[model samples]
Target: MLWWRQDDDERETDDEVEVRGRSVLVLISHYFPLLEVLDLSYPLHCYHGAVELSHLKKLRKVNFSGHSDINDKSLLHLFKSCKVLEEAIMLHCFDITFDGIAKALRERPTLRSLSFSKTNGPVKVRYESAYTTSHFISSLSLKCLASLDLLSSNISDELLSSIATERLPLTRLVLQYCIGIVQVLGICCNIRHLNLSKCSMVKLEMNFEVPKLEVLNLSYTNVDDEALYMISKSCCGLLKLSLENCNDFTKKGVNHVVENCTQLRKISLDGCHKVHANIVSSMVSSRPSLRQITAPPTRTGAFSARKVKYFLRQGCLVC
Candidate 1:
């Protein structure tokens, strides 16, 4: 039941305290069996304490992100102990390899939201193989997993294709900066919120259908007018869309979205040079449901600015 640390007069150096404090915490876990939520993220070197996590059967949510010492063995111990675990965020835990991640997923079928991105260590040799990564994702049981974030990872298009084929019941997926994904050929039909920002290789002809999609972000990508048109046509239920720095799109693409995506309440066209001022004005006039529209100051002036002001007066947010 010891909750507080010793007085400052008796405290050791930071390194010694951190190392020794973790050991104390692990020892305390043996006494307090009801410990449910544990966050060992940032600055806490839990290389040894992680193994002791198996003792907390009541643990539900855990965050082990940015712990340099957390490896597959630590994860194995965690999954083995926290069978009822629901959410686990392990971003930048460099020591965790794909094998460890796969094993954890297999053991904890109740994980609903999981993030393992940016976990690749400084040493490139520790990176997981594409095959192992793909196998783990595809093999995930479709009962509990609903949200997954894999930003800045080395996941390839082949793995994406496998995920598409598996069609797991994922609702939200983030794949920002995943350069290896060149196309998304209708793999995630059930996805409602999707972010593919900075995926430079995704081109105009890349075909994909996500009918239930509501929120989509394709910022800083190579998505052109044709691709935007395709998205508007397919994801008609889209409520929020961001195309920031997507310079390949023009007025034609914006028009398609304004015309088709009637459910759209918010849209961002910042850094888009070809979407003229008049087109934006036209869109504002047409789409009464539009609440927020973010565009460059140069393109949003005179008529567009006046329309935005009017919307603001009417209690809508237009920027």
Candidate 2:
């Protein structure tokens, strides 16, 4: 095959060609059939549903994030074609619709990690109704689907609640910048890590127990002292808690968490202007389980600086 067809004038300089467009895809599908990983992100030209990856049976991971040409037809093609497809990261793929995503999931239910951040929203959604939407999204009873990230999308509470109720084996859920999510009442018993940062109105409360939760991030959210209490009562196995930039909670709420979460190891309170330095010092002294602390900006005296060093020497990171 002609890898690089440089003209006579440019023969002296071997300018590396940018591997993009449908030609490169055709070559990979035909020649490199045994390729296990495929990344067709930010392509210079649109594939326009002209490629096939069915021959690449060993394909495990693929990234099509930020590819403008990725529409429903192309997405469905990939999922239906690749039998052993495990993980697909399609972040910022704007043309993807709810209908397309639902169909894709059905085709390749073995997907362990899937991301659809910054995709099409309600105003631009095409050929989808509430009934059809539920029919597909609820079909997310996929066996191996473990991690689901829907950042900066327009997913509503009802739909999100459905995913919660489906009882998928989700271990990590990142819903950062999803403004539609205000509450998740479903007990995320299997979730080991959860991030709800920048989701301003999210309240941390669930009906059932959260026995297996290990990490929780509520940064820049409207989570109040009451929310902290709810978490402390529920997620007793929580290992890390991040409340960065949150001002609604004071020492009262923090005390509940530090006291109740016996396994709590790491806590980040950076940009929390309300958390007094004294409270932090108290936590350092009292909470012996803490291994790392991201404290808010504080005016440190010589004695306090020495104490911080002392804590560091004692196998804990305080910064």
Candidate 3:
């Protein structure tokens, strides 16, 4: 049996390419005994027969995103099948539950990355009355977890807080379109990259520490000047910031961040109707380190074609 593959082939792109039927899945396990990665990410997938890859022992990563048939039992079976599974992405797998995830965590303590972003529906706790909800969620103590994406997943603040308490050294976090979460940055202090776009329920209040943070996305959220100020104060090391379509903040908030985050290299403000052309231009002029500015909406006057070309020539891009 192949313990590990040296490189990835074009056909098996981390298991991304689709397979038509259950027989194919079983055939893969039988022929390619050492299949380390499998990605079956698709859209609006109709239910199919289940063929658990239980015979495999070296499977490292798998993507079950957009599969409706892989429910709680199937998720546990998949994780248990892989001996050294490092990453598992089950986005839009509506049938998965917190209980399933809790059991799955026990089988993969070395998992480095996990995403349960269920866009189809919310993941719930099965046998709700029997299991302690907090205990079930707190079981997400993956010893090596680093990157987590819960975009559009209806997870409560308690579950998020549990991760923070575990103090897992998470470096990247994405919760875009997750309406249930209220406070993001507080729980993810160690995260270097964070995406909170379209999370209207978020409220940024009080000062916190996330000094290691480098990238942040607040596009289409309810972020205002006060929140921006707090972010500027907390994450001084931020390099790339996106505030696309965030109408609450004006030039004042933008300038505050620009002046504070000296290391900021890229700022994207596309769809922002309130920000004027001059503000973006001023950002370019003031910050020598600034390399790119995604200018505000065209209605607010995006940089002219000539001006864009001129700026690009000078090592800075304005568009």
Candidate 4:
């Protein structure tokens, strides 16, 4: 059975080519019984197939991003049919609603990763639906779900609180551009990788703690020095951190991170003009495990140039 298809550069025009209807999917279902992955992302033509996807029991991952026709009904059909589905990526699928997602999560116990990010539709309707969906998701027992990507969505602190209450064993979570989130609270302790990049309004609450967190991205956010200190104290296991465009942090804040987060191996200070070149150089010299540091070019001074050269000779990748 063909696992994937590569589109040819030269294809026949409509007059010369045979247009396949939705039955093509049905035919594939019968033929490629072992197909584990299916990607109908931005299909060349609209698919009007009402084919039962449940028949393809072996299907594990599915991507229907940019498919305008696939609505809540299509999702429901997939949920009821594909019993072993692990990942569902439906970015920009405008027709999907809260009801469909809630039902799917409840039915698919094996689902571990879901990304409904960047679904731009009607503004008022989307927020209302997203709020309801988040509430429903928080109430469920999703032990198998480890990764969730909700970038550019209307997620608020309420959704975060719900996830925390459930204590879902999520290891990776992405909430970039979730503008409604003002202060983050009630995050699960199991989260190891988190991306809150571009969430400018978000401020890390005092009680926030993620003991097992290893990778954290707070670039372009409003997080101040106090927030950084709190994170350094709480997330001592952090290995990689990004503070790009966080102008609020100065040398003191950066030093706090370097001292408290002893496990940090990589850090980014890009666009943070307040964090002087000398402090960055000293950080690299002090931390033996630190291997990579991304920051703007150092000011052209005799002392700064010597420090840069010293770090380069010490085998650190300074960018």
lDDT of each: 0.74, 0.74, 0.74, 0.75
Clashing pairs for model 1 are none
Tens digit of per-residue lDDT, candidate 4, span 1-319: 2332325564756433224534567777887777888876766655555344557889888887777677777787787788888998887776776557877677787789988754542243256555685666775777899998876677766677778777878899887776777665347778899898987478677575667999999998877788888988888888999988888878888878898888888999888877787676688867767878886435754345666677777766777
Among all windows of 10 consecutive residues in model 1, the one with the lowest summed lDDT is 119-128
Model 3 segments more than 4 A misplaced: 1-20, 43-51, 120-133, 298-302
Task: Give the alpha carbon lDDT tens digit for every residue of 20-131 in model 2.
Answer: 3445566777887777788766544345532466667778888877777688888888888888888888887878877678888888888898988654433332334555
lDDT of 1 at 306: 64
lDDT of 3 at 175: 81
Model 1 misplaced stretches (Cα beyond 4 Å): 1-15, 27-32, 44-47, 119-128, 203-209, 299-307, 313-315
Q: What is the C-alpha RMSD of each candidate to the true structure, in Å?
A: 3.9, 5.0, 5.9, 3.5
Report the lDDT tens digits of candidate 1 across residue range 1-319: 1233355466457678767867766775787678777766674233456776667788788887777777888788788778888889888777777667878788888888888766342224234577887877777664677888886676676678777776767888887766567665466667898888876466434355567989999998888888888988888889999998878878888989999998889999887876765555677778877888886436335445667687676545755
Clash pairs for candidate 3: 15-38, 15-39, 16-39
C-alpha TM-score for every candidate: 0.85, 0.86, 0.86, 0.86
Off by over 4 Å in 2: 1-20, 43-50, 119-136, 185-187, 299-304
Which of candidates 2 and 4 reaches a greater TM-score? 4
